[model samples]
Target: APAPPAKKPEIKAREGFEVDGQESDDLPPVFTTVPTKEKIVFLTIDDGAEKDPAFLRMMSELKIPYTVFLTDEEIKDDYGYFKKMQARGVTLNNHTLSHPYLPALSYEEQKHEICGMQDVMEKRYGKRPVLFRPPFGNYDRDTLRAAKSCGIEYAPIWSEEVFVDHWEYREWDQDLHPGDIVLTHFRGTDDWDG
Candidate 1:
């Protein structure tokens, strides 16, 4: 048998310049807070309305609330899956259109990406997301400002997140800590759910 791969920590690092809708080609550093006295965690899924039926079913049976960030590009195929889950629980957030790397695009481009998706989701499901999640956890100054102007207050990401089981099952071991956000994808995902 082959040796198993080394387990790397899946912590999302950010910079102080973490802004939304910037074209710096580099995500600004970030600031993260550790909750001192709380026992809760947040599990978030990325992309929109995946076609996988089993994952959808698993989501419903899990009986836990999760946040879903949608990029307009992902819904070009339609968002039937999302519309169904919206009724169940999954709260939607704004990702962007075409899943462009926000930090790599100019300020104007970044704003368009984030705000554009907000419009798409609102029009499709009548739900406007109040949170933003940048692709690949990357962001710069431009990214942040654009998101805030769009009514987003938080840059939601995983606290102690990882993919397990062939990278198919998205898992976040928040250890039941408060304000813990988990990250996952929808279509053609590479999460190991172990």
Candidate 2:
């Protein structure tokens, strides 16, 4: 049998964005990429629109680690699918309650969307996540403030995006890099032409 996966390294937040476990005046940092030189890229899947059993089995067998940001509206139909993922050690973070564009909503509205999901996740998943991702990678100051108030410590966007058949890059080099955060949606053949 193959060797067990190595223990993951402790991830330290980028300087000036570190959380000291105490409240601060600054909003949580919004970073598109991490600060590191390791030859590793974080995979983050957004929305819980698809619940393909084969995909779940493949990832489990392959031992690929990933993080998920779920919108309550999309996953409400099958929370059990994600509960299985959680049991397998996948960390599910907040993607708001309805995946609304945070920049368009009032501060109170944004809080409701973010905090509401925090409550749902805590109630359903047994733990609330400290990380959050604003829908569509869009956010304003109010969005960050609301997320902070909801106990979100980091709000990261993506440096690259992957689809069923193609990839998108935000950098001019158009290539993957160390510490990059790659984004993908919970989609299958039903949602895209694979």
Candidate 3:
């Protein structure tokens, strides 16, 4: 038999891994969702509280509910305008105290923006919003943690958004789907007869 095999070199594996006190290794490399229900989906939109009359009429006519993540700045400019829709089952969520590029801000600053929105939305709306959307989709790890500090669940993120800023003829095609989170910066005065 070979001379006692040289004692196997002691091997060490990573004992633990954590970042920001969250287990780094325990987390999935990415987060994804699986649809649990057939054809059931949620619609979400962000920004624009600056007196868009056309969007209001369209929303009124459509008579379908959608969630809007509103910035404090946008709401402040005309915050009261949302109350009518709030009564109509439209969900209001916090985007930020003001639209800020959350990832670029320092940790404390990000916390301020995220928490500020949570605080104000609760005061103004009678409930703390459970959703948050980073302005311009600018977010980082800090942004996520800051949002969680308050009672916000991750808001919906979209890879594509259709902006109908102009009231063009094509907007009224009526082939819209339930899951499509349609976005329009402003609206036109007349209805497009489907």
Candidate 4:
């Protein structure tokens, strides 16, 4: 009989957040946080409702790196705004075509929503993204299948979400952990007074 393939060894991080180093080609990557001892956190901004130049300036001055998950409907009116951010080295990812609930839709519908956004992002930003976030942080098995078919490499949900002045935590501790992914949306003073 033929010998079975040896298991890939896992690489441990010295400090800070690290993803499991074991490589698997068949499985799609789904992550909430990278496992590590470092005190680092990742910030992800969803939607594109507000295009605040001051906010951009502040983030740029702070040198914070965040990923933006843009919806076509929210950003089509001011695509140039995101273009400026992209020029500043910020990454723009896919949220969906119209921000529909993925689990509510069929697999083909889900694929259309995701792939359509990918087409728009590539046409507007000149690069196809490999990161996706379903609308309302809702998805199902078909969503993953659709995302994988569309070439997404990672799908992550938030550990915490921040509004204009307060934070909402998914964890009961209400405290941040290493490699935590934070979520925030684009909103103006109308949405929540700052």
Root-mean-square deviation (CA) per prediction? 9.7, 4.0, 15.3, 8.6
TM-score of 2: 0.88
Off by over 4 Å in 2: 1-24
lDDT for predicted candidate 2 compared with the true structure: 0.85
lDDT of 2 by residue, 68-95 (tens): 9999999999999999999988999999
- Sort all candidates by TM-score, best to worst: 2, 4, 1, 3
- Provide the lowest-lDDT 10-residue window in model 3: 25-34
Candidate 1 displacement at residue 22 in angstroms: 15
Clashes of 4: 1
Clashes of 2: 0
Evaluated with TM-score, which candidate comes out highest?
A: 2
lDDT, candidate 1, 1-194, per-residue tens = 12222663232334443444333533322323323334545567777645677876886786666778787777768787778778786687788898887778998899899888888888888977877888877777778777767776567655554454332222344243444555656645444333
| Overall lDDT per candidate, in order of appearance | 0.65, 0.85, 0.59, 0.80
Question: How accurate locally is residue 174 in candidate 4, as Cα lDDT from 0 to 100?
Answer: 89
Backbone clash pairs for candidate 3 read none
Better of 1 and 2 by TM-score: 2
With candidate 4 superimposed using the best TM-score fit, by how many Å does residue 141's alpha carbon deviate from the native? 1.2
